[model samples]
Target: MSWGIEIYEKGMPIKITGRSFIFDQIAVTQNGSKTYNNIPKGRSLAAYIVARNRGSYFTVKVENNKISWNSLRGSQSINGIIMVLIK
Candidate 1:
């Protein structure tokens, strides 16, 4: 199994409900009320992006996307399992 992240397109509410499993433990950038998560090795930052601003829609540029992470580290059992629920 590869330690990585996943991205999805679903209703905005679902992202907030499942923010834990989606984000890593290190934020690389922060701007006012918005904080961007660090791009982890083998992990994409898409899921974390949506997880930040829950219940809101935003344009995510894959070439230059942002993320936000939680500073909680543990054993690498599961790195990414982001699920976007459809309404």
Candidate 2:
């Protein structure tokens, strides 16, 4: 069994811990940014890159509710898994 954290909201239990209170996966666009408004119950944001195309690098940015991925060093294309964790 795994352990996490929760809080009571008006006598109801609300899960707010473990593996990032909330997690969202978004696809990378060759160029541009995407906005996500479903804010999770947490105080931090974490992101990871899972590259699909060999020898491709990207610069990822998370600002407010926006996530942007751009090919770096003239990479022809950008393809990968953007793991977003709100915790």
Candidate 3:
């Protein structure tokens, strides 16, 4: 398995490629409440939010070979690490 860190802006798409099996761990920061969509395809081996405030939240999503980050509130920042597995 291989891993990497990715930084993205709200509504941006990040591409991840490698072995056949892959996954991601994402942390996000937003300026307001938000909802995460399209998380990993598996059983969510694990997940959590490290931090949050009254006006901010976090979310993550993974689909196919790409991962897209979004904030329902709009205009937010996101950072996270994706772990890819090959089998």
Off by over 4 Å in 1: 1-20, 24-37, 48-58, 64-87
The estimated TM-scores of all candidates read 0.23, 0.64, 0.29
lDDT (tens digit, per residue) of candidate 3 on 1-87: 676533334546343334233434444443322233554455332223433455554454544444444555566654433333322
Enumerate clash totals for all models, in the order shown: 3, 0, 0
- Candidates 2 and 3: which is better by TM-score? 2
Model 3: how far residue 41 lies from native, Å: 15
Off by over 4 Å in 2: 1-22
lDDT, candidate 2, at 37: 77
lDDT at position 63, candidate 3: 46
- Tens digits of per-residue lDDT for model 1 on 1-87? 324343444543433333334433332222212234454445444333434333233322333244323323332222322221211
- Residue pair clashes in candidate 1: 36-67, 37-67, 37-68
| Candidate 3's TM-score | 0.29
User: Candidate 3: where are CA atoms >4 Å away?
Assistant: 1-54, 77-87
lDDT value for model 2: 0.67
The per-model lDDT (C-alpha) reads: 0.32, 0.67, 0.41
**Superposed Cα deviation of residue 64, candidate 1 (Å):** 4.9
What's the true lDDT of residue 23 in model 2? 69
lDDT of 2 by residue, 20-59 (tens): 6446777775766777777754555655564446767787
